[model samples]
Target: MLKPHQAKQAHGDSPNPVLSINQMNLVYNSTRGPITAIRDLTFSIRKGEFVSILGPSGCGKSTLLKIVSGLLRPTSGNVVLADVEVKEPRPDIGIVFQQPTLLPWKTVLENVLVPIRAMRMPVHEYKDRAHDLLRLVGLGDFINHYPYELSGGMQQRVGIARGLIHDPAMLLMDEPFAALDAMSREFMMDELQQIWMTTGKSVLFITHSIPEAVYLSDRVLTLSPRPGRVIDDIKIDLPRVRDVETMGQSMFGEYATHLRALFKSNTAPSTRIA
Candidate 1:
């Protein structure tokens, strides 16, 4: 395994990226004085690429996501999306968090239409799109069902549908499947890959699971422990259309092993939660 400081560096920004995170740093003033969450972090997500982030807990994975989503600003550096600097929440991007955050009273279709309504677009025009997204996520038969009627996995399916309703330029997922049981998490990984294959939207996924990240992403970016920096930008060369069976392959284990080693060597106190 490469040491944290010696891991492969990110490539240059030649081909235009859909999202560019340039040497980002974030610091907070607290009772303990100044705390740095990220340091000199830099990366780029090309059009239609699926990239996953892995690091120790409190390593600013979610913080980086928020910066890219325009919900939070970085203390230094900048995030540029589609040639425009992201200064505020963008209408062209969608975010799915660990929690589905669905409204219990609303039906699945209604929840999927939330973005459309929030954007002040005619809800009627997006009704068909909502139904199609639900179907794509394998919830066609449950459109009218309420969140209370669904299981944890099903509700997350609804969340995925909701995120895609706007036909956004990029999808930002912050461990969207972290709450599910093992079987369901694996199941959702497959579903997400299929959805990505069909839509070809750029994705920036944050997760602690090495296997999950390696299985779903075209590349995986491993960050150092807090004051996070990109230590490794390893490419996943696995064949597309992967399924659960793909996990049985040697290369799959190789990729997962490499990530685990990076974490073990990168973080001080020498521990990884997942």
Candidate 2:
């Protein structure tokens, strides 16, 4: 459990927050009685910022995202988005999970249009928008293809395109590139950076890979194990333009080695955000 005082430390005296979670505690009351999923967890993310949450398994990372998305209510605490209390799912937030849950029957264009359709907006308005997004994700040529015809990375691109269709204020991704091979993952990271640079929306991305987190984020937030708490929030000092080759540089390797040692301490589940 996190100390009560530390739970809200990140929220105090900062610039106005775009997203705020205050003293959040999540508990599951199951047949086994009650289990604490996360206790006294808290943080705030600013608008147009790319923040990555990194932690070991069972840290309630997904649970925290769910809470922020209004898919789950905290047992105790508050999640405020854009100064509005997030009691229900707001369409302004986009989410992409590890798996691309694209409807098999829908073509790539149609899949990307799902969110737009849900908005009940005029098809003509979003049709070109969808095409532009597909192109942005490098899937313009495959718009008519089905999910089965696409590779894992391609499918994930479709998922990301779909998420962007509505032009959400923030994107919440849960290991969006974890399923891809190394090369594919690298490409996806570049694609994500491209999209982020262009859109400049707030992003809360969750990942288990240090390199991926470091490569894609403006800041990487490391969480401690079960009933997770923010242990450290490190800024990536690496240049905005980076790649696998960046790992060989002193600046990149310094941070990577420091983070590696933190995670390898063995006694503690340490993490890094840079």
Candidate 3:
């Protein structure tokens, strides 16, 4: 378990928080007994910030996102997004999961419009926005293509476009690149960073990769093992518009090394973030 005091000491004061999780806790009712998935996990994401949550599998990383997305209710505490308490799903929020989850029958452009349709928004109004987002994700030429016709990376790009179709203020990404090959994963990281930079959307990304978290995040939140707690909140001071070359720099290695050390000390090596 992480010592909250150490976490607070490491991150002396938080910036203006766009989302706040205060003393959050979650307990699962199992056949055996109650299982605590999270205990007093507290943190915040500031406006237009790219924050990554790093932790082991089954560490309530996804659970935390669910709560933040208003898909699930925490046993205690609350999640406030943009000063609005997230009691239920909100139209301004978007999510992209590990899998693309695109409708195979739907064209890339059609997939992007799913959210707008579900929200009962004027499809005509968001049609141009959808096309613009697809272009932003480098899928303009493939808008007519179906999911089956696209590569894994391209499909994930469609997922991202769909997430942004509604012009959401905040995006919740749950390991969106975890399913890709290492090369593709790295490529998607670059694309994602560029997209985030271009869109300026506040993002809360959940990932198990230490390097990915360090490379893509403005701040990395390290969580302890099961019954997760915030162990460390380290700010990445690297320059923006980071490219593959940035990965080879000394500072990148230092951040990766520091996070590796934290995982080794706080959680099992087998489930290390990297």
Q: Which stretches of candidate 1 lie over 4 Å from their true place?
A: 1-14, 270-274
- The C-alpha stretches of model 3 lying farther than 4 A from their native spots are 1-13, 269-274
Compared to the true structure, candidate 1 yields what TM-score?
0.94
How close is every model to the real structure, measured as TM-score? 0.94, 0.90, 0.93
Q: Write the per-residue lDDT of candidate 1 for residues 1-274, one digit (tens) a residue.
A: 3333443344635388998889889997889898898999888889999989987789999888888888889999999998999989988999999999999999999999998899898999999999899999999999999999999999998998899999999999999999999999988999999999999999999999999998998888988888888878877888989987889988888777778887777764644322
The residue-by-residue lDDT of candidate 2 on 177-237, one tens digit each, is 9888999998899999998888888999999898888788777777777677776767677
How close to the true structure is residue 56 of candidate 3, measured as C-alpha lDDT?
A: 81
Best by TM-score: 1
Residue 94 local lDDT, model 2: 92
Model 1 clash pairs? none
Clashing pairs in 2: 220-273
Cα deviation at 233, candidate 2, in Å, is 0.8
CA lDDT of every candidate: 0.88, 0.82, 0.88
How many clashes (backbone N, Cα, C below 3 Å) per candidate? 0, 1, 0
